[model samples]
Target: MLQAFESAAFAAWPAQQSLDLLGWHLRLDRGYTKRANSANATAQSLPLTASDVQAIENHFRRSGLTPTFRLTSFAPIEDSDRLLDACGYRACDESLVMTRSLAGFVDGSEIAFAPDAAAWLDAFAHASGKRGADQAVHLEILRRITAPCAWAVHASDGPSPACGLGVLVGDQLGLFDVATHRDHQRRGLARMLCGGLLGWGARRGAQTAFLQVVAANSPAIRLYESLGFEIAYRYWYRVPTT
Candidate 1:
């Protein structure tokens, strides 16, 4: 199940460039989010060696980005983690992938749906307070998604205080980029928006919903738990010693 979600996530949050080498998926996206810029093991049986790790590092260096690896709990990468540790790689930004069944879920909020990718990007930027290059790259990623997607906002009549993204891969709905404006914190905007996205997915025949959140974000974790999501797996990034 984790592997299936891994594939869906790579598709849902695609990078600008992707290369498959030695049973690993290497991605690059202008040094943006780690998920889009890190090397990830594609299978459990990959025979990754220290030399392969060095080659991966050299590839990223040539691209002007730091070489990073996303190590998942389920992907036993032939002691690659040990090799990275030996090479002075530090682990950080551990995150949890939470999932829930959409069966019998209910959401009745009058949530607003963005008409297009650009509109959704605008709402997301406003809610997330992200501008300039972040928004530009995010828009490109959003536009690249070919799966059925939903871009939702808290309100339709005016500027949205909260926004979210949902990408439906087969029967699973992958939630991403859920954000609420700083001024609107503690008002349940995120909850409502997420509920709305889940409801949309359910209506579209989605059977499961999943989302990724930083493990250190206690408040967000609590909110996701309240929404019936449970930790399905954990993944973290390994960065070179600096």
Candidate 2:
């Protein structure tokens, strides 16, 4: 179900804008519960006009939901930030679409899969430090990885201190929800978790791996770069005004 959401989020672009909008709702509603949300809208041409902005804002306002817009940095808009500002929108955070080639990568020792749905949810929430739709979504992901995929955790002195989830998607392995306990930082646990997932991906005939990261996360960016992942695109967020 998590994979379905991700795929739907990606596929909704240029196909089903309303469904795409709902996916954004699921993501933000899960995160903020109610205070904030975002939406991704696109056009075939560049340079959105004031009227275009108003139209989008009206659409959301009529739906009784606040509107926040996300546009790619590569979008052909001149002074997009200014346009958004004029519409009462502000830049939130920048994020990158990163990809890595997985050819010739080798799988390392296997990590044990959690025994049941409850255990998986517990580990995921423990690693993430919270609960809600994100946890529920990951739980669904585990339920779907019944094939050439693996999920696992690693411990320092006791039971695993950090956990990671990964899956083979086509010719690529995708890693998500890699987290370490607050007490486990600076111990290289994140690296170890990620490395294990990369190894798993390689063994499963994946030729590449991809993940999204907030651009402001320097440490993660550095780690991924060191691991041979390169920035493929920059995605930006904006909001529409009523």
Report RMSD for candidate 1.
1.5
TM-score of each: 0.94, 0.71
lDDT of 2: 0.61
With candidate 2 superimposed using the best TM-score fit, by how many Å does residue 163's alpha carbon deviate from the native?
1.9
Model 1 Cα displacement at 29 (Å)? 2.0
Pairs that collide, model 1? none
Task: Write model 1 residue lDDT over 169-235, tens digit each, in one string.
Answer: 9999999999999998999889988988999999999999999999999999999999999999989
Worst 10 residues of 1 by lDDT: 41-50
Q: Residue 188 deviation, candidate 1, in Å?
A: 1.1
* Clash count for each candidate, listed in order shown: 0, 2
Model 1 error, position 170 (Å): 1.0
